[model samples]
Target: MDGTWLDHSRWPSAGRVLAAVSIMPALALAGWLLAGLPLLLLGWFRPLPMLLFGGALAVALCVYGARLEREDDAADATVWHVAATCGIAAASAVFNGIFHSEQLVIRRDPATYAQYAVWLADHGSLPIPYGTAAFGGPDPALVPSSVGVYDYGGAIVPQFMPGAPIVQAIGHWLGGVSGLLLVPPVLGGLAVLTVAGVVARLVGARWAPLAALAFAVALPVLYTSRTTFSEIPSLILIFGGIALALDTRARPRAAALAGLVFGLAVLVRIDGLRDVLPVLAYAGLLIALRRRQGRGERYARMGLPLLGGLAVGVGLGFLAAYSLARPYLSYLSDSVLPLLAICAVVLAATVAGAVLGPRIIPAGWKAMRGGRAARWLPGLAAGLVVLVTLGLAARPWVQTVHRVAKAEGDVLNAKFIVMTQLANGLPPDPSRLYYENSLYWVIWYVGVPVVVLATLAAAVLARRMALGRGFVWLLPLAIIGWTTVTTLWRPAITPDHPFASRRLVPVIVPGLILLAVWGLRWMWARARQAGYGPRVQRSLLAAGGALVLLPAVVTSIGTAFSPIERGESAQVAKLCEALPRDASVLIVERVTGERFTQVVRGMCRLPVAQVRPSGEAGAAAGANADINLAAPADVTRLAGRIRSAGRSPVVLAAQQAQLAPYGPATQVVKLRTRQDERSLVDPPNGTWSLTIDVWMAVPPTS
Candidate 1:
């Protein structure tokens, strides 16, 4: 190893490095909070604070960076890496927009997110009007039957965290409705670039572009970039934070910056906090171990600022949520205060343990004699393996207990179970879908060999960690492992092709890419050490890269040109255009109503209600139901009520049978839609054509 490998002086300037990484994102976050929080608290949106604070902070950072000394080491290589990453990201974004962009809102969650962004752009604050006047009152049925809208205190508020909406709002402000479509792809590109930077830090710059390419072209990345999913931005922050943390040894401020970024990630998605728990542990371990090695002062100087910055970031995140997203925060009301208190206690406990526990505990003192107990480590490992094998042999009984426990809380697990049922139906053996779909999606994308190579890379990294070296690399491994387990345990219930694969994009795909790259690099080094020529090493590496990437590239080519769903049909658009702004729309089928309520409300700016059959509005039923669709009398009564409220009542039904009792249809619209035909356990094929009748009837003249 060269001495320059450990020397900070050979690296680029801290300012340049920060510019290449986190500074812009941090500023943008600060600016967003500045502009957004005040609007939420004051009930008015103002752009001045955002511009002033963000502009001033950016200038200050630039000025400070200018004062720092500069170092040069192959500037062209850095530029190429940056350009390559940016190009890959841009191409991926374009590809995503072309194919995966949802024309009409199909999924409830994305629709809600889009609406929240629209609300933010227009109202610039919370308590988005339920637009109840269109529905004639503050009835629960007036609420859009979307997944992320919460009915709280007689008002409709978005249930998601504020981070992604705030980002989407930028797009809404810039380009109106079209801008919302543009935001995710841009963020997706940024995520790709950020992951490249992370790979460069963890592995080497030479491999960074390839890692970025692998991630940018993966099915998960391509699919997610086309929609306004929060995962994209969360990924940017997480990987960027990790990359920034790697530079902390050279630039102490980098640690604080990394902490702030990670903290913001939690604000974007609460699960991000769980993902970063390993980082906290890693930091604490560094502090404790360094102190025992008589490097206490240096470690404290760096670690304390990092911890403090993390607290600052977390504090700001909660503050933003409390001020701007109070209604959404209400969902977590029961646990928030307790969770905060617990976090504070844990932080205090960890700091104390790092500082004093090492001195007080006998195990800490005995660590100086570590060589004596090291020999027993192999025997202990063998015994643990034997015990684990025995446990696996008795797994059936253990699984039964686990199954019973899961069933006991079946309500909470209902969504995932429903997804499995949707994908595979009520089979004699049902657990296979969950496990099989999880593996199948991965295999479908990168091929089985790449999966094996990634596994090998993970094993190698694990071995390195076991040897008590390269602890820094453990963060990515921990994130990948955690996300993979959680996703497979309960993949999201989306009817999209690839079968719940979207959930794995942020961590799993990136992790696997990094692992594959590592594996290739390791192989090349081994080949060279074995006296192979440069040409052989290059050929081997190229072939490995191609094998790892070919499946995804081929799949993407096929799927990218043929989308599953088109935007709103021309006929539906015409109906929306013809419908009066004051019209009240009612959907007959409970399921279809819940799905399309947001589309009607958002696209047509009309209040829509769903009618459920009596006894169907159970505890788990959606919050938007006005009348029973099954009863002709109830439908007639709701129509009368709509007339009494001085609004035309329009009914939409999936079948002619549904509309027969109401009256003759006003018009029939044909919609070619994608239906989830998973009961047969076949891969979802092309769109299905369905005919829907729109009906309008006059109130009785009595």
Candidate 2:
């Protein structure tokens, strides 16, 4: 892994620096989350307590980091090492700022995540108190619910795990909405560092900048990092966990910290539980007595601490899910048991292997360990990976993936798929899941060269793992393979580019990028062995690096500089200003209620309720809704009740005519912004225009 540019031999490896710094972010996030969740469940998640607690944890992290053992030889890091890392981070942060999305309205998941964070930041509590007293108690005509918020016993409960919001709440305290929005980009830049660290450890430190540059320009990385999505932070924890696990410094603490970090990812995104499954298996593998040099104690030390940390982290996540976000858990009931069952099965199997293998199947296990079988398995494993890729690539020709639209989300996703089909000029197939085209989706952003190189690298790595080789890549390959196969198999979200691309970013995108860089390094090494001159070797490295980077840059080129959802904070501010102070807000329109119910309640500091829909009107996370609110009579009655209770009733709708019966309709929010681009059959090149207009009026007291 010789660098063609300057001699970087004396530089401290990116891996070492990563080991030193990666834990801080994860520990901070975990510290706040672990402290915040219990308080939130008990309605005590305030700013002062959280700040103090977080500060204490930050201090502890610094002390712990200072105590980590540093090898004196590679201890001195070069200025170039620090500069390249910081420069990459700076560039990524700048890119995020340029294209940062203010998805403040509750129209999609990003907006939902944003609103959830805003509420947490401002109120520091869960199950937002309904403030039913302002409207003079409960009425059948009024509902206190919004898109991703559910009503429970007169309180508003935000859907989704509290981890992401808890992390984003820091941004709110730092500044306000702008600061809140800025956190994601900063996290995104940190993500660049995390990925580079993984590459430096597994690949060469020389390749860290290349990995950083490659993923920095990747479409999914760009898209997820610019908004309040859980993917970025989860990525940091997952990759940081990987980096920590590979770190030999302060072996016990490092292993334990790595486990804790992986566990916390489950708190951020539930999919993280599935993403870390391989680690669970790896833990078991380490626990099982391998006829090796270090003996059983060596493996147990590594395994036990990791297992303990993972347990605590997972326990915290599930506790938060069941307590703070029970409705979200209910909504995902169908998959929850299966995920747990799988985890249980993996855990049980791991236990069984560790406990019983020596007594029952020693010969067979030893044979598999280093016999002819072990030598042949790598080639077979590599071939299997290629075969699997081919199978996925050719799947569309033989099968059309589909999901039964039984659940509300499934139905909406079906509709989105159909719409995306129409947009792509293909025949509308409501049932089409497009899972068969998963391989093509990978190709769309990374290009054919990356796909090919990554596959080769995966195959090579697969072969290398058989005889106790390439220990650094063992868990990474497992995590990446496990997630890639499963996500591509069943992407359960809407089958649209950029939107569906999130499924790829967490592990798959960076994992493949790391592999592609490794594959190029592998190629260079082989060329060097073949007596190729330095010039030819440099040419090979440059060409391969270009293959790894160029397509991702080209793919993200369109939206890289073009910011979507711009001016959204301004529009929300304007709308908040238009709402009269001390006014009891009654949202009569379905879409308006869905988009602004919580906005008014939380942001405008008004007691707001929406008319209970009669029939065809329901809230939407990303689905299209009709402009009509069917319960004007219900709303009028509610307004009369509000007036009698000594409160002025304000009506909100999408159009002037809708609010005409109440009073003069004044458009409060005329937000014109760009929506995230959607493409089912191809790569998304640009964004679509989104126009949201909110009309408001005050009803007569008479």
Candidate 3:
């Protein structure tokens, strides 16, 4: 080896690690081919251990890569990071498969997004049952079910910003829902790498790789990046926009790219728009400042390229959203509000600029030199703008939220209670392994420590040195503002709020890591100033290491124990396997459950079809048709539906244990795992009652 090559001894080799990450996608595809295609061909069979084993192997590869560095060549770090991210991303996909799926059979909100992707890709719009289906089969699709338009059955599916869904749809067109599920992480990984590149450019080489690793392993990003969620996509746009703006040299193409990304980011999460408002305002102020300096043409030149980029991104976003939403225009009132408000704000800002251009330039100049007040004035203005925009956007959203809250009262309460406790400093419950529960507590418990430390470091750095002072603070401030607003406004408990910890995934994770790095560097500089002894420095390093690693260690343990339980899919698959396929079943749960049933029917071609509750339910129960009870009331109604059918169809009860009537007739099939799930049946009794309480499922009568 040449002398220039970095050492490569202790581990298998860089080539091996890089190969490990690249090989994951191939392994995942193989699993799908083996498990998924086989199930599709051979009447549905359980593929649990196969899926889990594949996922576990992928995760192991990622974790192994995280620790190994056979070679120390700085240039090779990017390859390693990419490999780790890709490998981890594939692992996450496998894990998601073990838990929830997008098909109607799995029937959950996360799966609902997947189903929606399939529907859109196939039909260019949401499925009819999505809007028209009622909560539980006993109810018509048009009935006022609590699950709302997006709920699959268990968790509330997030309303993805246009970019993510469109991209997901494209993936679906290629390889179905599984393909769509893979897209978010891929895009997210690319974004993370881009941010690392930006950091390498801005900060010195010493901190960038560490910062990149920190972001990659961040619990919030890891969890969300594992799913087909929108937060990561929005983050990509926001960071890409910032990177575009920070290029310093006025390249129109770069500015245009920045604008395009900003436009796309806003479409993914409107909150992202709020986060970047200050950046956009800064861009304007920069232009105005340049003009005042007698660089009017140069200012226009800078503005034009960015504007062009914005146009391209927004145009694409609108086309995507319009295509997806065309069939459900009635759903528009809330969806379009943000876009309208944005238009209004741009117009108003343009007018204000025209009116105050001369006066504001001087004030802006004063604010630039202005002390503490001036230092914060820009942020304050941006905050006010965001608040105002939210208010305007709220008009169409209020009714939708109220409906979702009332319908999903239990889930809403649970989400709210958990989120509130997390924000207030309560430890997470290991038993509650739902995505919302794990994410909410994890964000508060893990995120707060990282953010607080990073914020303090940036504050110190800004004060102590003049080099890249405000610029260094810009990304952190945008992140803080966005994180703060999201934590407060889009609380886990909020009705219609997509309940995933992944929503917090952002470029800020790396930014914070860099801040922590700066803090260490700062302490060392101070140690030198004080003429501290070697022992003192060692002690400081030890203390710092403890502070950083303690919570991380705790969180890692928590994550291991708190694997998410996608109850709906697991239960449904169990039901289908145990029940007779030819039997007609009236499956009922919450509104979310009803949606799940419909989706499963679409995917699995199940004989169950949810119809509006009729007085004749008692009559239909006895006719060899299965009466599957999912919700609370379904228990009392189950026996009647059976008696009405004339013959006892096997009954499946969810949640409740007691089988009071037709005692000998009831045969129970309970789900045995760490998860708390049970199903009781009425075997011999001709007409029996069954309560359906699992996440999502459609059963046959055996």
Candidate 4:
């Protein structure tokens, strides 16, 4: 094999070792996405088939990867580095496991994702059934859908893409709810390992552990990993794709696999489509310029496979979106159309360039690449990065970001922002987006030092790439820099801590930290070249690592030790068990229906519906609730209809008194848990006490 970047044997030992650890989990996730969707369509998504099909696909990938070889291959691994990476992976799992959140309540996205997985694990189907037969028929007062699940043509469809829940369903299949909760943490561990793998490949082997530790201890990593957030899995795929692409320098077959992994990120999170645009451009450029990937291997082996694999992965995502998640896709049409247009433009331009560049003055391309202007580009690009960052940092002082609510969720988000403002003692401003302070969000977690170092590293990478160097840093720099600036500029989520922070978890935070660690290493090497004493060099390195680790750890420390949404799973279990067998449950109160319609239907595996809000709950207990509820006459008619249909009718409510109008209320679920803090102006501090109660009654059939 040519001794180029593609030859894995030449990479530092830690890269090879970390690669082995990081690759499997990512591939496993991709395999699930590949295999699970079709089976879901067929209503055959049981554990045994999923295990057999998805597992076989993953094994095939590993076997194919194992065949990569070279005549000059040298030992490319060290036992200790392998041990450290494995240890990092294990520690992340254990830490997240110990602090795992039980977010089963249907309040936010995490709970929504959890419920989605719960349905998949239990039923192995899409477009959840309304089970309206038990209620005699559908009534206007009784709707099939609730929060996080949409009702289209009387079918209960879940919100968001199916990728995260599929992984979580596997966890549930293995060990029930406990296993499902464990999935995110395990993915988190895998993500930590993958981040280390990237650092080993791009930075240096010695910096791998520090990178792993820094990323592992950060707030977003812990927060996302402790719950069923899509970001962790997306993180795994993004970095894992990069690692595979780097391996393609030796194993040409791995190029398609890398594309598959990168493309699957769209399935995990829709925003991932935006995150991977650079790779698409880069691959196109490689083919357009006829760059050598290996000895005698050019002409789009990497480009074609990368694009093909991406199409398959992205095609599956779109298929699922149009078929199973149409409501979710429709809800996102405003953003989705523009994103698709951008992707089309990028793809068209890439094709145009590849077709035209060779035919239209090929030698001129080289001249420009090697020209005097190219020599000066590094400095100019580096300065631009610096200037842009400084400008963004100063942006909040001069301008405040605002957006009008365009949808139902956006309206709620605006109210949430107003509520948070009052909590923080600020004047009401519903349209305030808080995006201008996105740079400060970085500083709040990683501190000024890591951000500074990350900037330095980014500048250096741009400079080196300008001079036709820094191949290793190119993709990392592009993906990270592009995603960082774009996300911070328009986070596009509710501007509350822990909620808005999820935007930073997958790419922005970890990528910046990885770059900062690499920057620290560059400085150390420069110091040695400057003839500094070993002690001085060591001191500088230690301080830099501390700056990287300490602030992040301190920022996350309080929330790290305290897991929120405790006792939720147990409460769900109790509520499900307490319902009478063959019961057609109907919720009278609004909050109860919104929070438990999906939970009761999915987790309890029972037929459930909610009556519209009465608008007569004048007491404080029900006064603050949202959602539409029905009058007592309407609820009574629905229950009577259920009774006449040969089903026992039960009424559910948040308070015992809310059920008093129908029958004697029995408290089924009494839960007290801790909730993540919702800080708007400041960083998240700690958890808040959260209490929920569920009451049930079997209405008299007379």
Candidate closest to the true structure, highest TM-score: 4
Clash pairs detected, candidate 4: 6-249, 6-250, 612-629, 612-630, 613-628, 613-629, 613-630
Which residue pairs in candidate 1 have backbone atoms (N, alpha carbon, C) closer than 3 angstroms, thus clashing? 103-567
- Tens-digit per-residue lDDT, 1-702, candidate 4: 665978766654543445665566777778778888888888888989998997788777765654442222223435676677679879999999999999998999999999999999999998898888899987877877889999897788999998888888988998988889989898899889888877776775567788899999889889999999999999989988887777676655458888888889988888888998888887776666554333355324566677677777777777877878889888888888888999999989888877775565357647767788766777998998898789889999999999898788789889988998987788999999889999998888888999999999889888887776767567778899989988888887888897778999889888998889878998999999999999999999989989999999889988999999989988899988899888999988878888999998988888998887755543433756433545778878988899889989999888876777788989998998889898887889798789999999888866
> Candidate 1, residues 386-482: lDDT per residue as tens digits?
3432443344444431122133224434455556565454543322334335545666666665676776667667655555556667667766755
lDDT of 1: 0.60
TM-score between model 4 and native: 0.94
Stretches of candidate 1 above 4 Å error? 1-38, 45-79, 103-106, 131-147, 286-300, 316-349, 357-369, 372-440, 465-468, 485-499, 554-558, 569-575, 615-652, 655-664, 667-670, 673-702
lDDT (Cα, tens digit) per residue for candidate 3, span 1-702: 665445545445443344333223322322222232223223232234334643454355345423332232223445455455445444544443343322233323445455544544554433234322112234322222222234344222224443454445556655665566566556546555545544443443344454455565555555555455666666655654554454423343446645655665555554445555544444454455445555434434455466556556555545534543332233444534764686668646854664466578677657666567656654555456345334533433442222222333445555654564464355533223232232234334345445445555655544433322345345345554555444434333222112343444654454555566566656766897899998998798666645544554454433432334333344545655655554344434333345444444434334343333433453455564333333324433543454354433333223333222313323322333222111011001011122234322222232
Question: Which whole-number lDDT from 0 to 100 does residue 399 have in model 4?
Answer: 92
> What tens-digit string does per-residue lDDT give for candidate 2 at 315-400?
88888887777888788888777888999999999888766755554577577876788767878989999998898889899998
The model with the greater TM-score, 3 or 4, is: 4
Most accurate candidate by lDDT: 4
Task: Give the poorly placed runs of model 4, Cα more than 4 Å off.
Answer: 1-15, 66-77, 291-301, 359-372, 614-629
lDDT, candidates in the order shown: 0.60, 0.80, 0.44, 0.83
Output the better candidate (2/4) by TM-score.
Answer: 4
